[model samples]
Target: MTTMQLEIQAIAAVVAAACALPGVFLVLRRTAMLSDAISHTVLLGIVLAYFWVQDLASPALILGAAATGLLTVWLVELLVGTRLVKEDAAIGLVFPVLFSVAVILISRYARGVHLDVDAVLLGELAFAPFERLTLLGLDLPTALWVMGGILLLNLVVIGLFFKELKLATFDAGLAAALGFAPALVHYGLMALVSVTAVGAFDAVGSILVVALMITPAATAYLLTDDLRAMLGWSVGIGVASAISGYWLARALDGNIAGAMASMTGIFFVVGLLFAPERGLVAVAQRRMRQRWEFAQTLLAVHLLQHEGLPENRVESRVDHLVEHIRWQPVYAEQVIRYAERKGVVRRREGRLYLTDDGRRLAEQMVARA
Candidate 1:
């Protein structure tokens, strides 16, 4: 690989990792859409910051974007607090106005300027290496430092407040009852998400920022029940998506950010189909096994019910199962064989009889019901 391709991959990986850290909690909280809202609204923040400072490279631009992201969340919460709109509705209402206003400003006043809407929506990662930052006598891509700093900040903050974050995410009522201030934790997470979004805006664009943030974490959720395991899996999945998507883009001569987003979707599909306990295939297998076992239990119960009754004895033969239970021929045969193997029923002459063990089990099953 060329140096540029390697650098782009490295930047994408770092951005993915940074976004995925808080994204786990976002997914758990069902607030994944907030990433989309904050990412888009942050553009307004960047534009306003640019107008004030007349400089795109200033740190104040990031601060403005971060603050704008926080404002978006607060506005949504405020609208929700008014009880006139739901959370999703509030987000939908707020972000479009902010984003459209920014777009209008860009077209009206900054049309001939370097800032372009297409660049903000879909970043040009190939040119990322050209924007260099010289740090400690080594020149590196600016996105690498920006994303790396955000990644470190997310790790430290999440590590320090892991317990509180967990409690706030899963059980806000309990957290509030215990004086943990769930509201503060929620807003803190929003703040971090906004900062992460801004950090990634230059490399992956605002659109893919939400993809890298939410998709890997969601895929990890399907694979594990443990939060720590989910976090680890999410990081691994994000890095894997970055690396694999880089190669995919190279192969197809396609958009790298779009390829990375597509890879995240592929990972989620794999989890949905192949996760050990919760996957669709495993779930179907479990349901089928349950039906088979229940069918065998029904056969045993039927045999026990007809035992010691001369009138019903003629109806207790194995052939009567299809007529009595309405089971398909193949299914009835399978259930009968299973019952015999379990010693729940015995065949004597042409009749089926329940064993002593079978009678006891049938009675217990009835009692439990």
Candidate 2:
């Protein structure tokens, strides 16, 4: 409604979208937790750079954060390569040490500065609009300019290297065999992620940055299998979360960053429950169908085996299935009705007989078995 409100929402949306771009690959590559590790460890870069330059606003801080992000990744990978610890264990081991060192440095040397762990971890987006930057003769929130630029950078990089990223992401061995340096692409992506995290973490905080990076991409992954569609969906979900989260915070008079993070979880739960093919409901329904179909196949095979045998009448009687095949009476009735509807079996004079198609299906199943 108000200008400040609009600016806050815009900044949040841009940050969310920017984070979501690389997040798609992170989710696809099964490295989503790296976002969390990088988000925390990058603080060490900022602290070190600030110590070196004694300036909070220096460009060196960004570079420092990016390098620290890459360092985090390299350290984790190095640990994993040794097989001494798994990827999760490596991330757990590396980020805490880096983040802890940064915290100690801030408390000891930078105690008088505005760089505090709480501010970096849980930023206040309501204050974001007050920090203005003049860009191209237009005054806007600094977060808007920074996150917007990062968003554009992500778009260009991902567009130019879409195929390479995709190939490397899905199959690194094949990508390397085809002359695409997957390792280079991987580090490049990590650098971009680090930059984006640094840009976003200042305004939205590390918690929201991690939430935006992983949640939207994960939610989109549940909704679609195509990489491009997943990217689009992830961006859309992020923007939606940002806008909706602003309103939620307004309604509850709560923290905007935390509200935005909560919205991402809400969207993910919705996707998990309702996504067309991969959702929990769909999976449950599919399993139920498979169970019924399998039961019908067993019924057909049983009938086919008893057809023309001395025990044909005894085994083929509809009620006899409960005892002969160990099916419950109620379940046996449901299976018979389902098979009848599918034309797999027919009940004639209370006896079950397999149709021609049912017999063929049974023979095929038998051959496979």
Candidate 3:
């Protein structure tokens, strides 16, 4: 692969992982729209920071962006707590006000500065390679380093606070009762999300950033109930989507970030259809098998219920089933075979008798079902 393509892959990989991290908690807390809200309001932070720093590449940018995210969360919380504004209304109010302010700022002052909607909402990863850093005369794309740093920071923070995060997400009241400050953990995560968003925004833009973060995690959720497995699978899905999207974009000459997000979306569809145990196909097959077994078991029980005596039932077996139960001969034989295997019936002196386990189970089924 060319250096640019490699750098794009690396950048996407890191960005996708970061998006997935916050995405897990966001999805669980039912605050997924918060990411969307934060993504839009980030424009205000970028504009405000740019107005002060006069440059996009500065520490103030991330700090300002994180502050804006916190402000968005604060506003949402305040409105929600008031009961005057509904949840959706708070979300609706936060994004428009902040985004409008951002637009007004750019229109008023930065029109000639090239900080347009495209740069704010959808970043230019094509030019990422050209924007590089030299380490010992070996040049590296700025985005790759920025995203790698963000990934490492997220890893450390997540690792250190995994228990608290899980507790805060699953049971906030219990978490608080346990002397852990769920609020503090939540605020810290919000700040981390904002910082990750700002970093990713500069590389992949808002739409792809949110897509990469949420889709993989959402897809993984369908496959596993275990958090550790979900986290692992989510990250794996993100990386795979990044790689596949890169190749697809290459073949079609398309936008890399957009393609990556599309790939993640597709991954979700595939998982929904094919995941085992809970997946559509698997569940259907299991239900079909279960229904067949249930029908056969019911037939055996019906025959045994009619026979009552073991000797009469076994002696009259093949003819008795066909006569009493309207089941075809072949179906009767199939049920007989199954019952014998299940220890539900046994042949003794050319007679069939229900075993202890079989009698108890059949009795319970008849009584309740």
Q: Clashing residue pairs, candidate 3?
A: 314-352
Q: Candidate 3, overall lDDT?
A: 0.82
* Tens-place lDDT digits, model 2, residues 1-369: 999999999999999999999999999998888989999999999999999999987779989999999999999999999998988999999999999999999999999798989999998889988888898999998879888999999999999999999999999999999999999999999999999999998878886799999999999999988999999999999999999999999999999989999999999999999999999999999999999999999999999888999999799998889998999999999999999999999888999888899999899998999
Give the better candidate number (1 or 2) by TM-score: 1
Candidate 3's residue-wise lDDT over 1-369, tens digit each? 887778887877888887787778777788888888888888789889988999978889888988999999999999999999999999999888998999988899898886887886888777777888876676788888888788888889988999999999999999999999987988888888888888899778976778977889889898999888888898899989988988888899988888888899899989988988777899899998787678556754664575655456444456566767677878777776787787777656544567776677678788786
**TM-score: model 1 vs. ground truth:** 0.92
State which candidate has the highest TM-score. 1
Better of 1 and 2 by lDDT: 2
What ranking of all candidate models by lDDT puts the best one first?
2, 1, 3
Worst 10 residues of 3 by lDDT: 308-317
Off by over 4 Å in 3: 135-138, 308-369
Give the clash count for each candidate: 0, 0, 1
| Root-mean-square deviation (CA) per prediction | 2.3, 2.3, 3.5
By TM-score, highest first, what's the ranking? 1, 2, 3
